[model samples]
Target: MNSKVVEEIKIKGGRVLTLVEGDITERNVDGIVNPANSYLQHGGGVAGTIVRKGGRIIQEESDKIGFVQVGSSAITSSGILPCKAIIHTVGPRMGEGYEDEKLSKAINSCLELGLRKGFKSMSIPAISSGIFGFPKDRCAKILVNETISFLKNLENSSTGIKLVEFCILGKDTLQAFQYEFEKSKPQS
Candidate 1:
């Protein structure tokens, strides 16, 4: 769970968007978005780590909720974690038809849920970029662009979201996200 903010930028409406390298479970944002399966299993990957750090109650609550459709999201208590809630989102697996659109919807779903919950800050990971076999570069691009689109459209002046941190893991994933964010920066 070792963590640090590698880069940050002030987007439209003065929202502080950051690219963080570390475990999502350690972030102290208002909510942490988990890239989960449709059945909400927390047996491995980031989902497992979240349950391990946050507590089994996270999985128990997810089990209670049953299933979440792809490109959708469901909220659960953060358990022992610092965040107020855990937004579980289902991203598309590789080879799935319309993977790009589904991933976009999944990211958007997390943001919309976070907005509705009045979360001022949220930590999200590279959805479906792990065992699901999504190309990290593409996932990073989608994650960064979708978040920017949401913030610019809503404008933090009238929204509760003041910060959005991509709490990424692994060197490759971090690099990919960082590169995408760098590309998004406005020229001085």
Candidate 2:
């Protein structure tokens, strides 16, 4: 599968946010965010792909961490994958109350985890937009907004994060993210 970078923008603090049409498991970054279940299972979707490529050690570590609350995140070794670690975040399933808030919190949780780990870069998928059933357009807006908010709020001491890529799989989703990103870009 060819990974196409649809858009890239420089945000505050010299960090770059990119929208890429690709598999998140294939990204070469300091960490990759997995749109995971609260139980941290690696059975399907992006979770399955990450486990298959990064090896069983990722699952093994997840087994130890056990359950994560919706909107919270956990970290695990990435095994043989290109990235150093995988950040697993639990997002709300549709029909659940407060889906928007939960989705925003999930994205923020991933960014907070990356910053705390002092990671230089990370890649994230559209959390909750898959089996969790979050609307793609809403997901794009929440993800991009939360990411930009996080970057803008960062202190000089938390400057390690320099790049964030939204690695989307489908064309529609990629366009959704790209459009939101473009709208959110700082006006020169």
Candidate 3:
């Protein structure tokens, strides 16, 4: 619960994008994205943390939904967590043929799903930067760029998403995302 917003910026449609350093599980958003595998296994990494804090209902719901494809996402109840829902997204492995594109698509999938689900705010972590073996810096850049592009294109659109937060955990991971967020600022 020690999460803190490192920085924030406004995108199109007056939406807010934030770089946060803390645990996603404690975020008080409408939804929190889980960087899951193809099988929706809640064994380790972010997925495990979500399950550990959120509860077994999350995994049970995931089992019912079965497998989710890479670059795609599935939704489930947040169990006892603060969020209403958890968006489980599958990011491609490091050796995958098209890692960058797949990661971008994964982020898009999470955002699109959140929009459709009427999520006004959501928190996401570095999708493929953990055990999936993706480079943290590249993952941060792609996540920030793709999310900004998607939000910018939603001008005048019927989008309910007003806030998108990158709730990173580790010091190194947080620094990576922070760097990307700062670099994204427009020149004064």
Model 3: residues >4 Å from true position, as ranges?
none
State the lDDT of candidate 2 residue by residue for 116-169, as single tens digits.
999999999999999889999999999998888787776354467899999999
lDDT for each residue of candidate 3 in 54-140, tens digit (9 for 90 to 100): 999999999999999999999999999999999999999999789999999999999999999999999999999999999999999
Give TM per candidate.
0.97, 0.96, 0.97
lDDT of 1 at 53: 91
Task: State the lDDT of candidate 1 residue by residue for 57-173, as single tens digits.
Answer: 999999999989999999999999989999999999999889999999999999999999999999999999998999999999998998988888877366679899999879999
Report the backbone clash tally of model 2: 0
Which of the predicted structures, 1 or 3, would earn the higher lDDT when compared with the native? 3
How many residue pairs collide in each prediction? 0, 0, 0
**Lowest lDDT 10-mer window, candidate 3?**
150-159
Weakest ten-residue segment in model 1 by summed lDDT: 151-160
Query: Candidate 1 clashing pairs?
Result: none
What local lDDT score does residue 45 receive in model 2, on the 0 to 100 scale?
93
Which 10-residue span in candidate 2 carries the lowest summed lDDT? 151-160
Residue 39, candidate 2: Cα error in Å is 0.5
